[model samples]
Target: MNKSNIYQCADCHTGSGTPQALQAPKVRTHLPSVTNYSCTDCHSKVVVNAGPTAANVTAHYAIRPTVPTSNYCDYCHGPNATSPFPARNKTIPQFAHDDPGWDGNATCRTCHTNSSVSADPLANDTSSFHELTTEYGDAFNGSVKADCVVCHVQKSPQFVAAPNPPHDISGMAAPDCYGCHGVNVPGTEAQKLHNPTPTTTGGCIACHSNNATRYYVNKSLFALHANVNTTDGMNNVTDADCKTCHHGAADGTMGMKLGAANSSNTYFCQDCHTSAGTGPTHPSDPNLIKDGLSHGKTDCRWCHLAGDSQPRPLSSQLRYHPNGPRGTAAGKNCLSCHVSANLPDPPFHAPGESHVSDLNACQECHSNADNHAVTPLTQNTPPLVSGLSVSTQITSGTPSQVQFTVSDPMLQIAAAQYQVTNSSGIVFDWTNMTGTFNSNSVTINANIDTSGLVGNYTVNVKGMKSAPRTDPSKPYYPLNGQWSSISNAQLNVIQPTGYDNGTVYGTLGTDIAGATVSTNTGVSTIANSSGFYSLSLTNGTYQLTASKDPEYYPNSSVFVTVTAFTTITQNIILTPKPTGNISGTVTSK
Candidate 1:
């Protein structure tokens, strides 16, 4: 606390050249107590006025052992036994968690007058200890730090304070326990690394050895650990712990960063067990997961041995596939994450639904999956989609989201993806139409720019599936099917408004008012009594037809072309056939 007494490197180190072999602070450098928080480590501020000293202090000031030590606090808090407080140590008052002022910042000041005297920086620091209060920060009132509980019992007074970050993780008795098992100790990345045996018969080391230099290459030492599953208390296993002993990163990479570009990870399994090695080895190199697909998206343990003292299948030959396909007992045993009873997912798609079938692995579509091939409807009519339509506008120079609706029967609406060709005939991928998928109705909310768009734009929509997009720029797999109607719409950007319609005026000449006239796009209307009729359609070629009366023969269907919003006149001729024709049967073998 004495500024003049604080050691300054500048005292012996002039702005001149380097000193000889031995520095003046040789004695202090060897001192058992020099630390960043110690008086010897901080330079005296009295030299602040001298420009060279200030520059040296600003540029060269450094503490080798910067971390605060137990003795650092003794500088300002040395024992004052001559006064009222009875101190134990010759350098400072004896500190313990049980003191009356230990938990309260204000209460400690009552006894020690030094501004920093009561401020203990070691384990006695009170910040990590939460007090029991009405507004304990983080709603963790009354919670005590594991480090404190490891050594001391709760004091007379209780206070609320948030526990230190070191002790905040769940399933940990104390942060100190990280040396052993770690996360999802019950089932996490560190769970596998969390094994700690109080007895000398350690677990992971039983099979894995780091001190390979220490003689025991004897098979007996390692073979014992092959199937023993020691948990990290939480369900997670720390990959770091695994890498610490196992030479997993022969390539020198650190994390298990997954992606197609990081393909080297695909060969990581070979670093340890080796190709010549045996059994359920890493599922790559001719992996259990086929195709250029990835199994990185899923938890590997989901399909591996899980409970009841089962050992990991030592060899791939001892594969564990507990289910069949399509919610049946088809038993091709995918070992998928689905419950053991029903597998291959439900309401499966037709074989052609997926283009990636060659990839043929569960992880292809199900791993961290989204977007699925909708169940294919046999025909594009009915139940496929009704009134497939949309309304759009350019708001604030940017095209507002084009809103469209389709009947959702199963109510398991996911998402919708679309594509459109602009006026210049340039085809481009539209934004993924994802957001709210209301039950019984699928709505697409998407935004597109139309400022440069001239002619007309055609938009098509398809339902999203649970399959993840392997190539995100394109579409998720199983995209071959799904959706009743190819949700299509034509909205003219700058073209003048015109009616796309035609008249089916030449009727059977009967009560034409009830005669039904329909267009190719499933748009249907009735004819007037004067045999006058018209068809409303978009700018496209369509097949035109008139429904036949109960007493008359059906009219022949005719193809017509319509553009923009235009009304075109077309004549339909209906001829009635004679009553009945005699038929004779001829047989040939």
Candidate 2:
């Protein structure tokens, strides 16, 4: 390791000597003619004061290469274990040939060329020492491993000092596929052997066995699995292969237990992955299709994409929808996914029945709006008859009738029925009731026997839709179906000549037009201007009183008597209180 040169290139370069003196070449190093050396040992000590020279390798000229022959200079300058370039002499300026950063380990033909090129560079050549320059150049390439440690290391490219002992790699990482099949190239083993893959020609048990190299990494199983390349040359492993070679296999029938009873396996996939369906109402419940004949055959994502639970139609699978599988905006497609038979009227039958026609008409008899549940039409809404009115006076010799309007909100009522309650407490259905279809109003002749009495009668009217029930015992004569809604009116009977009617008149004040006049019989009427009021009382002596305001003196009751059907007059005035109005505005800052 001495800096002193035996063949003194300094003498030829700058040490005051010979033919090479005029030009200082970039390289100058030689072997001492007197020193012990060998052509077999390319590493024979000859420090490069300038660099390796012809004198240094002159001994290897006549030598023939042996089997597995390689570039001799690589032993000292390449990336091999024996390469001492890393710790070379400080002033020598480390390098192989011309370039200061030259790499001595590369395919020889890259720096040396011939047309007889073959796969093995060393075996293809047979040249003399002087033929070295003509056959081989001093060029360099950096694309490959700078030094040949990529091939020479055999196990790993990571170098370590010895005597303290290099790490065995055994406990570094455990059960990793890349631990043993590690590669730095960017391809598969089948593509390039130096490249990587999860492949193991001997199968899963081969690397997982006692004879396997015990090495590992600190990464998680998922990360390792995600990065594993299962390309060509991968171990021919299958479920059966694992079971056949396993001493302890996964237990349980429906659920997978990946080891002996409780002993968990390193393949910690949690048995079931937790990533597929994660929404709160993601339609992932298996029972959402409890008795589903077809819908139970797919993953939830097929229908619940973007979280809309109203599954789109996969008509081919269920055959429920007439149209082929298709999706609608925001999952509002309802009819295609629904195929239930429910109706609201009698002959109440399921759909696809003999009586049921167009399925689209479901809404006519049931709740059919999108997102709505099926509810019976009759139960949800009812037809109603309102705006009832009747003629008060029964004409002595003319026919009389009751007129009223009907509003059928449900449109279920096609006809109406009525009953007349007379003073005798006997109720009879109005058999002569006729309705004008367009206006939806009914006209029924009261058929009042004007000679019976002089009192009030009741007309009860109702609306209904025919129920078409098959049972003969059911009430069917008057009308059918259920009464959607009901209402009533009053009919008054009066004799124009026989009984005597009397009128009483009175005055409460000067400006009381709306003051009420009443009798104990519950008959009441309002007063006109000048506070003069009148009422007709039938054959009875009546006691009447006038109404007064809160500030007026109380009224004095009036008594009036009637002898015949004539007008009887009784006038009275209400007095006022002693208090007077005191008005003013009071303001404060």
Candidate 3:
């Protein structure tokens, strides 16, 4: 076998004799340098030529720490690996490529970079981090937008990284919980913390505990604090605070704080100050009651006035008097208007011109308080007339006697005298006078010869008062003073001398028959057989007239002139006048 035909492994290069052999390093013959020669020209026998091996390539293509899970890939692809290989066409795991820059070690820059890993799932971008979207979105929609400081540090210069690390897994680092729940610390170190009381549970336990001190303190402190300075310590607080103790106080119950009372304390000044049952005492002033003075209590409204909290002037406090003569010094008396029952005198007299005792009582003008006046007795009577009325009735022949009655309802008859006058202007002289004069009426009787009188005559009755004589020595007449024409009555006399004939007859005409006539005087009369009127008459002229009944003519005498006793036939014609007849027919056109 040829030595040139020995075979060697490519990796370990263990040699073996075969047809294909590993050649020794050969010496190249020098050839002339040629320009622009292609590499394929001499490498035709070598079909495969790997690219030149890289130098420091691992360091140049190091995986970035920001790529998550790429550290696992660096284990195999790193330069220190026995057979570091490139991931030429392989797919990487989901988490394997995450946090690529992280070298599985801690460093300031490692975490400072954009590739820093966060333990909070909320901070991860690819893993549905909710810190930016969900929490902030909910806060924006809520009534109170979430403020970072409400749950975080209360004050600044907060060393977020020292004793209390920036990322506190214990969740107790927030200072906001100290507001309601007092700080809790060891008794030895109590001064270091604010409000270091055992009443509070420190840190997150104060808020998140099953029975948290913050919850209990917030529930009770508002009401307990309000009771500090009230009349009744529990009396006046807000309804919300009262609801802590009385659960229904907010919805209206007896437990409501600061509620108004059902009744109010109110009274009138007159009720206690006036002269009533148990009233205030005052001194007596005689001048007040005597002058009918308007005392202090006269006008209650003057002091009280009208409206709420109206102020009374200091000068108006004194009482005013209105009795004397309004504005006159003597007229000013307090008791003139106000009764003694209502107003009493003041303790001491005011330094002024006071009322005097001689002032009249109220009875002088206002007889009594109820009906303030004096009434006089009066009686109504008819007016008195000094005249007389005389009535007379004369029957045919003898003189008639007249009765005279006089009245003076006011008793003025004793001073009166009467006279009568006729139409002839002659006064009826009182020949015999007998009459009695009383308080109301008087009556007298007088005889009068009324013979031969055929007409009416007026009797004027007049009255006059007997006046005292202007000169006492002169003779006095009965009618002297102012006289009144009292009244007059008329006297009528009828003639009784005419006589009637003893017979009467009826007259008949051509169309007037069966007519009857009779005499009106008390005498015998007859209708003659010839129907002609005949009568005996004294020497005088007479008028004779005739009338027909239903269907006859009437007749009348022209005139019967008789100078002596003679048979005068005065004839009357009974005639019927023709009544014109009118008849016509109406025709329609």
Candidate 4:
């Protein structure tokens, strides 16, 4: 095969600004399954420097042609190929069973055995035909053809008529299909600017649009609201867990049902932001819903509508606001719509913008026209978090303290959250902790539970302001300062050692003295004269192996779970060596 000449690294790198090491050809890693191959055997190699004058070269790096006349994979797997031997002749249906719109009646020969090259797999199949094995370099693993199920479920095609699950996920719980579907929600602050809407049409919009049923399934809420485990002393929460908080006979009665935070007979928001606490202050009058609570608007659509101009109930105002305070196009804040200076296209105001010096002052002076409130308004500014300190070392299944200082400009610090995330990015939000607050700077010290956890982790701290209430019957707003809190520190959790005591025996139930008993983690111990072995191992599950050399075969399949500071008994029985050699074979020789 005549191959096209390519450019060597030295062609471009031996120039003025290039490093000397970039001048040489790199050692290529050939597939281990093949042998006695060299550069240009399957593909071309670097020859001249990269330039317009170079023949048959386009760029400094090798970029495969968009359309190639030949299939390199066919060289080995083709019907008449011989070098690597043709692949097994496996029969496959023209259309897979799971292919969308397939009716389950077509035969394989319709396409495979047809004379038309376009319809024949033997004549047109290429190296890039299968994605897992072609694009990702994954082994076919005996699969005759690429399995679509590797990405989407092939069996549940009835859900959507497609290979994947149905797009409607209204009833799905957390961590189920969330690995692929729920997780695809837009992650960046900028990408999350859409107005939240409620829709039956699933995908990310179903939840991001503020569909209450689908909202809590977000992975980020797992630490705060979702029941992650039983050890946390919380009930297991399902997709319908919303009823746990919203099903009270009355608004005030609902707030008290949540158990923690003494907010009896008060609005639900006050559950975490009690009036007596340091959280943001809540308005006092239930009748003042127009001016004080709902910003003088009975219809929630006005504030909630965005670029689409559609009033989407339960949708977010800030997210859908075509122009937000962060320099979008227009602003959505009270000053943007109320203050005379802002006018038609109220300019964007960044956080801590000097344009509105005092929040309370703006609330008192804004006019009462155009459904505007005539009374004072309140807006929450998150608390400032700093001086975060966590116990640098601790043991698994133990409790430790995570301390951080919080200060709020508008109200007192009410609640704080401490999150511990491992290297794998699994966040553990420590809930149900007793918090102590002081006057000058609220210092939060939470008892962190480290059960079933051992490794390096990052501790993040954030604080919220007090919630002052005007009326117990009205909805209380919760303003969280989590986005501003960036204070973090490292923590290391180690497993406490445990003892493993057991006896090793042979197949005949006789003690196997001096037997070697070992753990899968490499810790080992030898049995004494009585065949009793004792090993000190860290808290974890281990597979034990027992053997006495020539007398018995090793038994390495015994499993045991070990806890910290506890001794567990696990007896390992070794199989005796097979007896009685073949004497008849020698006589025949």
Best by lDDT: 4
Overall lDDT per candidate, in order of appearance: 0.37, 0.37, 0.31, 0.45
- For model 1, residues 1-589, the per-residue Cα lDDT tens digits are 3336554544443234245423543322212242223333333322235654344443234433222233323333345432322222233233322222334332222112112223444333422211212222212234532232232223112322222222123233433333322211343222222132211134333322333322112223223122222343332233333333333332334221211112232222222233443323333334332223233222222223122112432221222212111112123233322212111122221122222223244444445331121122222222234454545533223463566665433223334667777566646674466655423355656666665565567877666432333243432223432344467777555532224333344344444445566766788777666656666555577776676576445564777777654666776665554568789999999
Once superposed on the true structure, which residue ranges of model 2 sit more than 4 Å away at CA? Answer: 1-359, 363-377, 430-432, 436-453, 467-478, 484-486, 496-589
> What is residue 516's positional error in candidate 1, in angstroms?
48
- For candidate 4, which ten residues in a row score worst on lDDT? 190-199
lDDT of 2 at 366: 58
| TM-score of model 3 (CA atoms) | 0.21
CA RMSD of all predictions: 23.7, 30.2, 45.1, 30.5
**lDDT of each residue in 232-296, candidate 2, tens digit only:** 22333333334321213322121111112211322211121123322112223443322212221
- State model 3's lDDT: 0.31
- The candidate maximizing TM-score is 1
Q: Which ranges in model 3 have alpha carbons more than 4 Å from their true place?
A: 1-404, 407-433, 437-441, 463-485, 497-546, 549-589
Clashes of each: 53, 6, 36, 18
> Which of candidates 2 and 4 is the stronger one according to TM-score?
4
lDDT string, candidate 4, 329-401, tens digits = 2334544443322111212111121234444656444453233344433444555888777885898878777
Q: How does each model score on TM-score?
A: 0.27, 0.22, 0.21, 0.26
lDDT of 3 by residue, 372-441 (tens): 1222111223223433444444433445455555543322222233344456665555343444432234
TM-score of 4: 0.26
Of the candidates numbered 2 and 4, which has the greater lDDT value? 4
Tell me which residue pairs clash in candidate 2.
Answer: 10-15, 173-215, 173-216, 173-217, 174-216, 467-481
